[model samples]
Target: MNENKEYFVNEEDFIVSKTDVKGRITYCNQPFLKIVGATQEQLLHKPHNIIRHPDMPR
Candidate 1:
């Protein structure tokens, strides 16, 4: 193994909110709202599936 190489921490172990590989919010940390600047009410009904354009390859 390459001792000089670095490794990335797993998402669950880090504090970061990420979009899934398919670009959707699957799991969010406590700071999700502060990061996205949205309220629970704003995020409730708005999963990425809503605003997705038909042209998207997915």
Candidate 2:
């Protein structure tokens, strides 16, 4: 795994997404896909926690 790699959202870009009432992603824009490093098929209907990094601070 590329643990040292990081993705950043450009200042001029916007992240957009829609999740179900249970917090499962239903739709996401390109910026969201880029930041999360996932394709639409990989993220659709998936839990938001799928993007949580183990090293991320609580």
Candidate 3:
């Protein structure tokens, strides 16, 4: 991971919440929340890519 990167939450499981620069619940699915073990509030502050699993190619 990039040490310079900063985020409200970390990508651990399957919570891939995509949001714009502003904090808003733009996109999210049931599987995302369930696998990550997080609520909507958690991703609200976090970035859209916080849930981007490492397996995803750059």
Number of the top TM-score candidate = 2
Q: Per-model C-alpha lDDT, please?
A: 0.56, 0.86, 0.66
lDDT-based ranking: 2, 3, 1
lDDT tens digits by residue: candidate 3, 21-54? 6655576667778877777777765665566589
Question: What is the Cα-based lDDT of residue 42 in candidate 3?
Answer: 78
Better of 1 and 2 by TM-score: 2
Order of quality (TM-score): 2, 3, 1
The superposed Cα distance between candidate 3 and the true structure at residue 36, in angstroms, equals 2.3
For 1-58, candidate 2 gives per-residue lDDT tens digits of 6578778867438888889999999988897889888899999999977887999873
lDDT of 1 by residue, 7-53 (tens): 88765454454456666655556555665666555555345554346
TM-score of 2: 0.67
| C-alpha-based local distance difference test score of model 3 | 0.66
Q: C-alpha displacement of 18 in model 3, angstroms?
A: 5.0
**Against the true structure, candidate 2 has what lDDT?**
0.86
